[model samples]
Target: MVDEVKETTVHELIASPFVGAYLVLRPGSPRGLKIPRDKYLQLGRKAADDVCPAWLVEATRRCWNLDISGRGVNDAVVVRTESPYGYGRASYGLNLGCNYDREHCYSTSA
Candidate 1:
């Protein structure tokens, strides 16, 4: 018997960063932005298992320095990219690093 390892996908890499991470998806905007992990991951998972647009996969590859073939993701990542459309409607700007849990926020929108 041989031991096999699981190759992390671009989706998985991006998803690991956690919510409220300051990420910059370039080619669209140079500024880093805090993403709403709840909503972003929802769409990301859909794209990974259900239907992923080409743009998203490509951007993921570039962002993580992985091949476009989708073989797997790399341990090291690339910050800049020629295309950032794969991120969909992700907002751009540096995140303040606050973990905002919708269920645990303990406050309604004021």
Candidate 2:
């Protein structure tokens, strides 16, 4: 049987509350990112303290390279999980700081 795939944006992917790490499928590569939360943040910003994995280097292209060549890196993202299944494990909530503007810092389900 064929595996079910769902379409979602990278922003949504990072925000997904997956219970355990899930596989990320992309052209030319398919890997899972299961680093610690701190290291995951570093990977998000492309800042690695030590040598970065050769596959990890493509995180940027895979996340935001939404070029219109019908081949944008992000255009190919797909996950098997149709719904978030964890207790907000991947949730990155707003800063909700008093100093930050409330309007900009607040998150909406929209």
Candidate 3:
């Protein structure tokens, strides 16, 4: 039998501990060479299953499916979620590789 999917709101998904943990694992910016297609698929599936946000899952799926090279997993997520306020908020607090420099850190203003 097919399992019924439970509906979850953006707020609820963001509030979920699972989503929080998943976001912590995701990169907020590009940091390395592109992830291999096979690896991206594997990681994406794992992330989709672990997170409560439907949008994040979908974004992971679509980003991994792209043919572009040199894009890291976190870069994919950042590119996909940077727009549209809701998705952006869902991905907030991500480690964007600029946390050390006060002038460049997103949390700080120039």
Candidate 4:
């Protein structure tokens, strides 16, 4: 008999309502994020205070880099250009005042 194993991904984890909402409510969001709500909360240990959000974003950006060679760090992740849009700005609490009307502001999805 052979034992079967299963692999889990960040997207699968962030699909739950709890995890989804937490990520959405986070400061810097990705492009098309899809994960379990409970799992997302577990990874961030509280969506309000995610430490290495950029690191996660960077991983996704790497995929894009494989296609576009000259994109450079600028094309790494949406967070790199999401400050102006209010997607990468979590320090403003949860009031939803972001306009997202500039190249600087962008969103990256996992």
Task: Give the candidate number with the greatest lDDT.
Answer: 1
Off by over 4 Å in 4: 1-30, 43-50, 53-55, 58-110
Order of candidate numbers by TM-score, starting with the best:
1, 2, 4, 3
Q: Can you write out model 2's per-residue Cα lDDT over 3-110, one digit (the tens) per residue?
A: 989975542223121445433323333333453444444434442234443444455346545222323223233223225335432222322225443443465647
TM-score of each: 0.27, 0.23, 0.19, 0.21
For residues 29-86, write the lDDT of model 3, one tens digit per residue.
3322333334334444444224223444454446543232333333333222223322
Total clashes, candidate 4? Answer: 21
What tens digits encode model 1's per-residue C-alpha lDDT throughout 11-54? Answer: 33333232335243433333333445453444334532244335
> What is the C-alpha lDDT profile of model 4 across 29-96, one tens digit per residue?
43334434443444435333334344344544553222322333212222211233334323232334
- Ordering by lDDT: 1, 2, 4, 3
Per-residue lDDT of 62 in model 4: 52
Candidate 3 residue-wise lDDT at 90: 31
Cα lDDT listed for each candidate: 0.39, 0.37, 0.34, 0.34
Question: Which regions of candidate 2 fall more than 4 Å away from where they truly are?
Answer: 1-17, 23-48, 66-86, 90-110
Better of 1 and 2 by TM-score: 1
